[model samples]
Target: MSDEKVKIDVPEVPSVLPPAEQKKWVETYKAAFEEAQNDDPGDVVKQRQSALREANRLLRVEKITSADQAKALPKWKLVQCEEKDGVLKVVTIDGKKYSFGVGRGAKQQAPAGQGGGQNGAGQQGGGASTPPPAA
Candidate 1:
């Protein structure tokens, strides 16, 4: 395999959140989402939407440029990934949406020293790699 390092263009993550407010955002989002899920008011959709909006407002997504960046984002804050026009859009708790095109000529290269080689077999006098019986 070619020993070329694949250049994966990751999304640009903005330092929007302050260190002090990290916990606050996490707690607020969890509480609001949980409330909407458990309370089950008549207008469940509306309630959930409102909660999502608040969470989104607090999330303050600044710049999401690519799918790799979107994937790199913390899973806790992500709601889902939507596809549109051959692009993958990342939706973060009803916040600003960002998308990236797939198969944009991204190269696939293996690391320099980690070639696909056979793993050590029967190192412990066994045909397959297995653990000793429980004692």
Candidate 2:
């Protein structure tokens, strides 16, 4: 074979946002991901807090990098972070913003078959119970 290298042509994928904006968001995501993975330790309380922060960061990463959210990344204008809560909330291009907490965007899963949607009307055993067997 000759010393000349083979050239491969790669097609550019179309994006809703301009390349510069996409690059900015991609860099932001990379920074956030790297920040979450840093595990430098401090005092006991700080260490615990760090662990919790790491966990929340990982959860946020999973949420944002998911298939559906990944597609929307180019449209994200801002990433709002709550350091106390350790949550990173994304603001979309159309100005929709949401914070993390109970019932914000995070969902609390009910135990399997528990039907946790009831409004505390003493609805336990809400399913029809079988009548007592004839004596």
Candidate 3:
């Protein structure tokens, strides 16, 4: 018998974003997708506003996080937060960056559940994924 057991080094899977965030991401991305399809910035902006309003509204509706906290402006939660031209450069939990006009990331989701993609599969692709990047 082999004295040493086989050491299975399982590859870590990525984490998925939260449902609330996923909902917001889907809404915004879908709107932008439609806008991109139409090639209308006006429509894009309009839909973008709509999405933002809805996102904020959802956050407000849920009351999970404060709608008015100095550091909690309730913008999209990103992998990284950047600032430019008084706008926020938020990288979606999936690493996609977008320009949010102004506000802190109102993401109340635990870091683990902040960026799950389609079908709630999350970044891990399933339950067998690795941890997400460090905050």
Model 2 pairs in collision? none
A best-first ranking of the candidates according to their lDDT comes to 1, 3, 2
Put down candidate 2 lDDT per residue, 1-135, tens digits, no spaces.
333322221122224346664455444444443443343222334434443443333223232332234334533233432212423344433333433323344332111122423221122454543444499
Could you tally the backbone clashes for each prediction?
1, 0, 16
Stretches > 4 Å off in candidate 1: 1-58, 82-86, 105-135
Model number with the top TM-score: 1
Ranking 1 against 3 by TM-score, winner: 1
All candidates' TM-scores?
0.32, 0.21, 0.22
Where does candidate 2 have its weakest 10-residue lDDT segment?
5-14
- Candidate 3 lDDT over 12-72, as tens digits, reads 2222445666656556555544544344333444544544444444333122222223125
lDDT of 1 by residue, 52-134 (tens): 55555766554665667777876655766655445565667535544455564322111111122222111234343346569
lDDT of the candidates, in the order given: 0.49, 0.35, 0.40
Better of 1 and 2 by TM-score: 1
| Higher-TM-score candidate of 2 and 3 | 3
Better of 1 and 3 by lDDT: 1
